[model samples]
Target: MKRITVAVLLLMSFTTRYGGQQTPSRPTVLEHVTVINAGSAPMSDMTILITGSRIVAVDRADATTIPTGAQIIDGRGKFVIPGLMDMHHHLLNGSFPPRPGGIQANLGRLLAVGVTTVFDPSIGRQDFARLKAAAAPDSSAYARFFGTGPMFTVKGDTFADADSPMPETPAQAEAAVNDLKALGVDAIKIQRDDLSWAIKGSGTLMPLEVLAAVVKQAHTQGLKVYAHAPLLKLAKEALSVGVDGLMHGIVDEPVDAEFLGLMKKNGAVYVPTLALFEDVADVAAFARRQAVNWDRAKLQPPAIYAPFADAAGARQIESFLNNSAFTKERLKVARANVKRVFDAGVPVVLGTDTGFFGVFLGVATQIELELLVEAGLTPAEALRAATINAARMIGKERDLGTIEAGKFADLVILDADPLADIRNVVRIYKVIKGGVQYEPVDPATPR
Candidate 1:
């Protein structure tokens, strides 16, 4: 076994070692391992070869030939799975006071914990470009970044804030999509609720007519549209307009037959951020959880959200979490709806809405997987939501989200089988992103 020393990892060159020596440039090999490709059964005694940033080969250990000068990783008892993704998150760090670049500092922690990919539904073009540049392959620490540039909302939407692009008419909606495309966004996020008032009282939710036009125009530019509709009514409206995905779960009530049928017919992906709802549903419990884990998270290197991890930030988060936004019964329905959606053949993907409230980055993706399993998804199926299904949602299936030949070599080496216990996802032994290897996080001292 080899150790990865943090001191040797250069921020500029992106280099690594096998046994405390300079690694060769030929290729990297993981020999005699068990692989879970998410959509398929586990394959044992396999050899995975990485050259440059792509996986060049995946064959049985006995049939594969060892290339000269290649760095070989002994994986006799390891299990490998594709790097996980947090499909719903916020990318901007400006909201947090006392420090800026919050999201930028978390890039290294994201890669350290096997979150090699992330999808932020709300971000500005400038921030997205900065995140993308920070996560470039040549950088020593980063996660593959994909996001919607500036979420769309109504004129007075509370979540819209100052950074959101508010579109009031069909023409404005069309222009908004065009502007986002011009900014090189990977997708468009449209909010169907104002959130300033009660869900039922919020006036002038993004008009359905305008939303339809936005969806149509975004499709013309080949960008997927993700809907942020927290309530069932709003979600139904978003679905009626044919958005590609729903970024939040239907928490107010169980999804009805009409919504399920619409989802099935339209092939709309669902990202049930159950963990987030759990935090919001039981504020006392959430506060307790925060009190216990806040220190550990703050100890992490780079301190991505150092401002938010401080006493003032903790007080703010506690005040926010203590507010009873949704009922306990609502969360029950939300969980049931997630199970129902999964059983009904709707694509239920894993997402934790990280970078908001108590949903920490790096670790939230793992919690989301466990929550999915609890919501009646098989471990493999839950894994798919974070891997292949997520990639497919963003039209990136051909390049990422799996351990296959010709795919980016982004993977996680685990000490235990996640199939047996979803919690094993946290027991990471190593992380490899874009064929670049990294030391895994120790749960006792995560950094």
Candidate 2:
């Protein structure tokens, strides 16, 4: 994929912020909406007051008056929740074997699905550097994109290739981290497994000594480090090495007391990214059996994804769908382990690994929330994973997670109650990002 210069991308991103209109920092009120904030029960007939981009008040409609001259929105019978976050997102144009697309359009598609914040765990440094430079400060036009500028992997690791900085020693690991920090990345992501382990059944895993050194260097720089560990042993190694988060579920087997202890000691956040395994299996199985009766929902493709739709990306999805059985057992193990880990008191964060070929952006977030519930978490718990828990994972808990006074007014208005059914989250009626109303893209349209 060709890269769009920062200037061009920023211009396109700016236009999307206010829907080609001037963005206002004025007052607004959402009246009589059913509020669900901070993992609590629904509070109906509430009026949430917003001034500029911060929520000023969340009061009962009968108790407080709407500010004069403020734009008033009737939110009757609508369920209001914090704007969703995807802790494990990606940009196909920025990953290995780059796909064609502009970043701005993809960001818009993410917003269209009510995702106000996104964290890409593994992104190429050059791509992240360009995006960081292009995005405007205090811009509300697109969902937030934070990431680790490329992933740290060993020479023989799955993602190793030209441009990949494969560290071979502990000294190299620390140096690699320092290089990433210099690029102004938000966090550090380390790859622990090789890609071929799933298909060809042969791959080299990153050594523990090197990972520990990487984690130490990252923490010294005040950056949280996340590890891409898909198996139980590798997950334990990452946790024991003091990684701040695990990017995938601990599959291959159930967790044990020692694993729980390691997680507790390190306070590592678990981001199952269940959709990665699940989608791979589902698509692959369907394609293998040539099933056609399934509902093939259409997703609107942002202009940036056009190149992907036409080239190797399209072929990759077909190839993956034809190999669904490869991930079937792995996904089952992940589902079981997620439940056990959550039951053991580990914090679970929501991440969909969207933008990986078939993984749709905004739509995947809602699906992930439902999957969380299916893995033995209550709806409230699952909501928190995407909200406050997600915010916590990225160390932005005070600024952008939940819908609370003095926090950024990023919220989603649902046509039905999500507490009654998690699927209601996809019934997006309206989206408010940084206190500005955003028109959402219909998820039904195929991209």
TM-scores for all candidates: the values are 0.86, 0.86
**Residue-wise lDDT of candidate 2 within 1-447, one digit each (tens)?**
221111110111122333233346345778899999756778889888776667777878877665555667799999899999899988442222345666655665565668888888877777787666544344446677788988887766645666566777889988888888888899998887645424555567777898889999999998998988877777778888899888988756778899889988888889998777775665433222211211121234244344334455545754634545556766767888888888888889999777665555456677788788988888889898899999988888998887788788889998998888988887778777766666655321311
Cα RMSD of predicted structure 2 = 7.8
Q: Report the Cα lDDT for residue 261, model 2.
A: 90
Give me candidate 1's TM-score against the actual structure. 0.86
Stretches of candidate 2 off by over 4 Å are 1-22, 93-98, 134-136, 284-326, 442-447
Query: 215-253, model 1: which lDDT tens digit per residue?
Result: 999999998899988778788888888888899888877
CA deviation > 4 Å runs, candidate 1 = 1-24, 91-99, 136-140, 194-204, 287-325, 442-447
Best candidate per TM-score, number? 1
Error of 1 at 206 (Å): 1.8
- Which residue pairs show collisions in model 2? 17-141, 101-304, 102-304, 123-150, 284-321, 298-445, 298-446, 299-445, 299-446, 299-447
Candidate 2's TM-score: 0.86
Give candidate 1's whole-model lDDT: 0.73
